[model samples]
Target: MQWTQCITSSQKRLTSASLGAITTLRLETSLIHGKTILLADLGLSSFQLTEDSSSTAFIGVDDFYVAPEFQTFRDGHVQARRASDIWSFGCIIAEVLTYMVKGSGGVKKFCDKRQFEWVPGTWWNRFHRGPTTPSPEVTTWLSELQANGEPYRVRMVGVIQKMLSLDPKERPRSAQVKKSLRGISILSLAKLVGHDLETAYKDDQCIDLLLGNKRFRSWLSAFKRTFLSTKGG
Candidate 1:
């Protein structure tokens, strides 16, 4: 999630990063950063191209981050799809935004009040289906934000609502999310960071941000060397 803050950084953002490395914090930080989803994780290792095909497909995940379709899979109703990852992306985004707007306990409250357990039927059935009303925390924050009529809040809410659609297909693709963010003016973008846009974008720390992660830097160096040798040959 440390990378998430970089993604929202004005001049930097995720222009050259991969989503697979994104944690809950990073996903939220992207919201603060402007839209421009980069798929830098295109490298083979990041895509798990070397993964053993004989390994069983992950059908059931016991984590709270598991998507609704995975829950349905556990119920014997359907199989999980690649799109399921996008759904999990939306949920993580929502939770992060909720935490930001409503304070630390916001997501916790939502999870607690709804009894969001890791069990199969407990999650999707409780949150995705049935007659459960919209969460008051989220609803209240959004409503209050919109009531202010700030373009920043309006645009932010627009992207969030789409990402969190109940139907996975209805949710925006990552590229589309980028497009939406790109459309917003820099002034609106400033509101997300709570200060002058110049200050955030000017931080020199961004240049060496990735180098702080020794493992990623080593892997990147090796990949670069390999690619260069192959090209020369």
Candidate 2:
């Protein structure tokens, strides 16, 4: 069983580059970046999927991938493999597109404690940044948007190939994910916030700041007094 939708708390704050990419895409067309939701939450079980089933039906959840579930050693954990991240992103796109084609069906939706989607960049930009397109033969989502006026289906095909490629080196860079799908109406998760669900999550305060209100602040003081007193710092 593949589990996608694992996002890091750090991702809630996007880098300047990530924000820049997203802003540019939005300027070009009223692009919408939706929240990052995992298909696993939908409870869709995986089957011994064949090559054919892979394309039309939902991809095996075991293979479902998203970029953010990747971990950094800073949080006291093993660093996430870049290849693993790319693979996960591929699953996210497939799951979303599949759901659009076939109703919820066997697929499920999930929310990780720390996952966040950038309102700015495609999965490719979320992973790597490049001045030019990375793939010559494999078109990126940005490219598709530039070439044709529509590319919903084309984008999914590329995500599937890169995510499932046996050779990690053969997979496309994350920079190309949004670029290749250029014109397609691959909706962003941002627009869905108030419409689909309501939360103080998208509020003005930083998640950490929100978590550290007056009550939490007192707790932090106690924690520091107990922990810091024990250490020199």
Candidate 3:
């Protein structure tokens, strides 16, 4: 679909760096070809845009998804940095991939083990120990892909590894991530499902199928009502 809003503040590389919060990232769903598909929730309230700074610029970050850089800043070890968002994105990808391969609640169970706690030394140790012993979710997902001979799964894992790098500077920028993912060719993935999708299939057409679906519109409306009522109360 239109990645315009799904992609967030990290789209622009900042001159300086700062820690910020992004607790409102959401997933919206729509029916596509008789199946429900998740889309990034890009409501006005979804993203909290802020400029970079040497200090913690915002609060209320979701601990479950907070980047290591933000954790370091919170611990008074470093200045806030936007590259933390890349880490957050990596976490999201990890969770999504886990859910896809392991089925429902996989990510919740994975996070439950960590309890969203990031002890500096312990966390750093685990971060560096990745690849050799990648997260169980990543390892399993890669295995599944390998079994199916999904050519791009390896490349996907590589990009994901970079995003989850322990050092923020080592993480790829948003554009780089986008370019890497685009190179994988969604049509190729679709081929796995026996769909003879053409490379000529426009991205907007796919977005239209998702966003313009009646089920999606209805769900969005109901979701908005529930979300607003909960907030208002």
Candidate 4:
């Protein structure tokens, strides 16, 4: 199959770059076809694509990836900001990291960890209990990633933590997230080359190293492909 076919295929899982692209580029969720619902799909007719900075008002669907604010006011219309997309991105990142470290079973356990009783005998798998507070279970899961001691995982957990902030204003913007990930990728390349991270940080020649490495270049190419293509969509 062609690369685009593979990415759009329901059978293929989203790469980390693809998840980032969805949020950063603000792509419409209708283009994605998969069992996992990454965004609230109330139907295309109910949703509007706008270019304004203000939040868009819509009725939200009952889905795990929907932001806490969306779920909190399900019975009525809710205004969703770009920060809402950041929250869903964070949840997806957490799951992706879990799968990377512990495989499919780990992803299942991660979901089970988030399931909580919101009402009498009614359970929900949400990152937050309400619009303003993150679930303790989610916090604990992030802590586990921090304690894992792997540099890439630890750095990613840091970004995910910020992305999962309860306050919409507290979440980093898409550009900030991109910068963080770029730094992490550079450090990862440094590690692969057995270069001292301190030196890598202090020197301006790190870009040269990143460009010279074939594997890093390939990864960068894939990221650009995923991000730019999704942006165009």
Reference-based lDDT, each prediction: 0.44, 0.34, 0.47, 0.61
Better of 2 and 4 by lDDT: 4
RMSD of each: 14.3, 19.5, 13.9, 10.1
Model 4 clash pairs are none
What's the distance in Å from true for residue 222, model 1?
43
| Model 4 bad stretches (over 4 Å) | 1-53, 71-75, 195-233
Ranking 2 against 4 by TM-score, winner: 4
Q: How accurate is candidate 2 locally (lDDT)?
A: 0.34
Model 3 stretches astray by more than 4 angstroms? 1-60, 74-78, 115-149, 187-233
Summing lDDT over every window of 10 consecutive residues in candidate 1, give the lowest-scoring window.
47-56
In what order do the candidates fall by lDDT, top score first?
4, 3, 1, 2
TM-score of each: 0.47, 0.31, 0.50, 0.63
Worst 10 residues of 2 by lDDT: 19-28
Best by lDDT: 4
TM-score result, candidate 1: 0.47
Give candidate 2's error at residue 13 in angstroms: 9.3
The Cα error of candidate 1 at residue 16, in Å, is 12
What is the full ranking by TM-score, best candidate first? 4, 3, 1, 2
